[model samples]
Target: MERMRIAVAGASGLIGSALVRSLTSDGHEVRRLVRHEPRSADEVRWDPEKGRLDPAGLAGCEVVVNLAGAGVGDRRWTDEYKRRIHDSRVHGTAALATALASLDPAPRVFVNGSAMGLYGETGDRIVDEDSPAGTGFLPELCVEWEAAAAPARDAGVRTVLTRTGLVVARGGGAWGKLFPLFSAGLGGRMGDGRQYWSYIALHDEVAAIRHLIDRDDLSGPFNLTAPEPLTNREITAAMGRVLHRPTLFPVPAPVLRTVLGEMAGDVLGSARVVPRRLLESGFVFAFPGIEDAIRAA
Candidate 1:
């Protein structure tokens, strides 16, 4: 638990930035790995597509948190953008894994990013780390992304793939996207709103990453989500209550299907993921449920 050297890729991202802040607060020496020249004092550079990186930046580090990848929801899944999504994850992961493997003094631990989408549409089933992977575009992407990190594991580094869920924060992440319409009484169920929506708060997501770092016994995929999962309607209702608003305007299923196309699977499909491994590992959630999380955040 002494001061540890940590290098975080995609340090500017929602999760990565939080990890940097948390590690620094915990008295860890944290360094940021950026895609471009960081116009500041605290950054190292890397270009994944070009297969370039300064592995020296990762040297002497005890932990390497890989949070790099294109924003999954940042763009509509056009044919080209879909390719970008897949490439951003697989290529970036490959570059980092390869870089880490070739380093003389490589990291002892690698916390790579994955997603609950790896389980695909599970309907009402509760999935855990040991559950078999599902079949879908998202699942395929997650599989490849994690596979790209195999070299690091082979190099004797402790590796964990965080199969994360919807991360909700008041001013950021998925909650920020839905708050406006719901708070304005213009938001309602999407499709039937019966589809499950597994989620975690920004606070717990950050804390869980740190917990993973501290728990040396953990490896492989761990579901980074709250123990209590909810349906879309359930989440919407909780948000509306927190904001003192009414969610009366339903987004028709046809509209979503039309706009999202194959991507609509993300919104329509169900994923009731559970943090079973983390829970069994004696990890406790700061926000175990939607109501408590919304109020605290």
Candidate 2:
């Protein structure tokens, strides 16, 4: 792959940080769009909430990857926090997209972040990139989040909406919370354990993003998940098997709702998403099976 200058928003985030390391290791120049004052030569200041970013900062970049957004599972979804979640994604994406679109020689591609929560509760039904957007807070939020990137797309940039699933990683995301619990032998199935979870290993998540960046022909929504979808029960078993612990207990739905508030619904919701487009595009996953993903995490 040819080395090129790339600008990344959310460079400090879990996925973003991983991507930055990957891009730099590949000999690409990385410019980080930060909220605070630039602390280094590679850093540039931008406030997504205020719709402010330096257009000149992105002048020579070949690609712009927007992974800026508030984490959904970071806190209880109070009305205010809910608004923050929505605004962080929608507004941040809009700010970056608009800025990128206005550049004299716009970047060749704009890889925007999205999530599988757009499918909402699909029960046992299989969903793909072609599936219709499901209803509910997350789905609605995702719709607007993707729509905010319209400017870049409209500007003729090859914009790719990466609809990511639960990223299994030891350092961050849901797996970060799960590792300790399971290690302590307290981890068990969530709710009824029948809810399907579409997931990808952290390794594959970064690799897939890089694949999207390289494959200029691929655009629009692409589901970033392992081909095989597993139920919560299966996931629990896999973790237990990997850790040599017992998967005997199951958390009830009501308790989860009581504890996590509105976030519990997402926890118990089923989304059997598949990576049809990615498969067709010849992107092979490093860890496709649940056991492999859990072990990697």
lDDT of each: 0.85, 0.92
After superposing candidate 2 on the true structure, give the runs of residues whose Cα lies further than 4 Å from its correct spot. none
Q: What is the TM-score of each candidate against the true structure?
A: 0.96, 0.98
Cα distance off (Å), candidate 1, residue 145? 0.5
Candidate 1, position 251, lDDT: 83
Tens digits of per-residue lDDT for model 2, 1-297: 788999999888889999999999989999999988888999989877667787888898999999988888899999999988888789889988898889989999999999999999999899998899999999999999999999999999999999999999888788888898998898899988999999999889999999999997999999999999999999999999999988777889999999999999989999999999999999999899999988887
> Which stretch of 10 consecutive residues in model 1 shows the poorest summed lDDT?
169-178
RMSD to truth, every model = 1.4, 0.9
lDDT of 1 at 157: 84
Instruction: Flag clash pairs in model 1.
Output: none
lDDT of model 2, residue 209: 95
Global CA lDDT computed for model 2: 0.92
Clashes of 2: 0
